[model samples]
Target: MTTLFISDLHLSPNTQDITACFVQFMRNEAIHADALYVLGDLFEFWIGDEDRSEFALLIKNEFKTLVASGVPCFFTQGNRDFLVGQRFAKYTGVQLLGDETVIDIYGRKAVVLHGDTLCTQDTQYLEFRAKVHQPWLQWVFNKIPMFIKKKIVAKVQSGIRDEKEMKSLDIMDVTPSEVIRVMEAHQVDLMIHGHTHRPDVHTFEINNHPMTRIVLGDWYQQGSVLVVNDSNYDLQTRPFFNQSI
Candidate 1:
């Protein structure tokens, strides 16, 4: 059996085609996998678990169906969807994992994450990340009216888009030293994550020991999936049409 991994779908009402593609993937492919791991950014931005939007319902239903089929699903909070809470997990049946979690892949240990923490050079973004992740702050935000929360999220997303244009590519990408440090701390030579939107397999050495990092891609224009089995692993992209679902 194969274990499938994906990230950065950024599904939202505006991205119906991509959402349909994700639904099709859940029904056709994920149902047959031994397990599925979502590294994060599963949605454009998650306000809170109280979200009752049609789009959120559709995605949750897909996950519920996949999990009911006996394929375990795991999720890690992403930079965009860190507000995903227990209610979402309960409704979808996906186990929420920590930002960095270790798992066994066909007898080998591999660390999986959303990949934002690896970008240590992006100090400004990191500072923002730290503030938003505070439990007390999140609790306060969640208590506010849903409409106000939506406005805040919209403004933040807009700011992020503008900020990204000004930030250098190197600052946004993961730091090699941080990756090495994380891998060493976890005592795992293999790591899998998504956030930088650059999908590729990286191979390096740590004190002459071999190390590997696999980056998953965003699904803005196409779907990205990583398939792992006993023998090997492959990073693949699936293209879809823009027609109505």
Candidate 2:
């Protein structure tokens, strides 16, 4: 059996093609896999479980169907969808994973995460993340009216987009030191994550131990996936147009 990994779909009403693609993936690809791992950014923005859109319900039902087929779905919260909680998990039948989770991929121990913490050079973003991720702040935000929450998220997203335009690419990408530290702390040679939207595999040695990092790409213009089985792993993508039903 094989396991599939995907991230950064950013699914939303505007991205209907990607949503269709994801449903196709669930039906044709995920059903055949041993497990499915969504690293992060599964949605453009998830305000809260109570603010479910029609599109959100559609996706949730699809996830429920997939799980009912006996394929387990595992989700790690992303910067955009950190509010995913027990209600969402119950509806989708997905197991919520911490940002940093370790699992055995076959016989190899692999560390999986959303990967935002590795961008240490993005101090501004990191500072904001620290505050937003605090339990007290999240609790307060969750208590706000849904409409107000929507406005807040929209404004923050817009600001982030504008801010990103002024930042250097190097500042946004993962820091080498942080990556090494995380991998070593997890005691794993293979690390998988998504956030920066740069999909690639890097092989290096850390503390004399060979290590591999696999980055998952965003599903903006295309679909990206990583499939791992007993003997090999493959990274592949399909165009959004081709993905449409």
lDDT of 1 at 15: 91
After TM-score superposition, the amount by which residue 5's alpha carbon in candidate 2 deviates from its true location, in angstroms, is: 0.4
Candidate 2 per-residue C-alpha lDDT over 64-181 given as tens digits, one digit per residue, 9 for 90 to 100: 9999999999999998898888999988899999979999999999999999989999999889988888999888998999899989989998998999999999999999999999
Taken over the whole model, the C-alpha lDDT of each candidate is 0.95, 0.91
Report the number of clashing residue pairs per model.
0, 0
Highest TM-score model number = 1
Looking at model 1, report the run of 10 residues with the lowest lDDT sum. Answer: 236-245
Q: Write the per-residue lDDT of candidate 1 for residues 130-207, one digit (tens) a residue.
A: 999999999999999999999999999999999999999999999999999899999999999999999999998999
Number of clashes in model 2?
Answer: 0
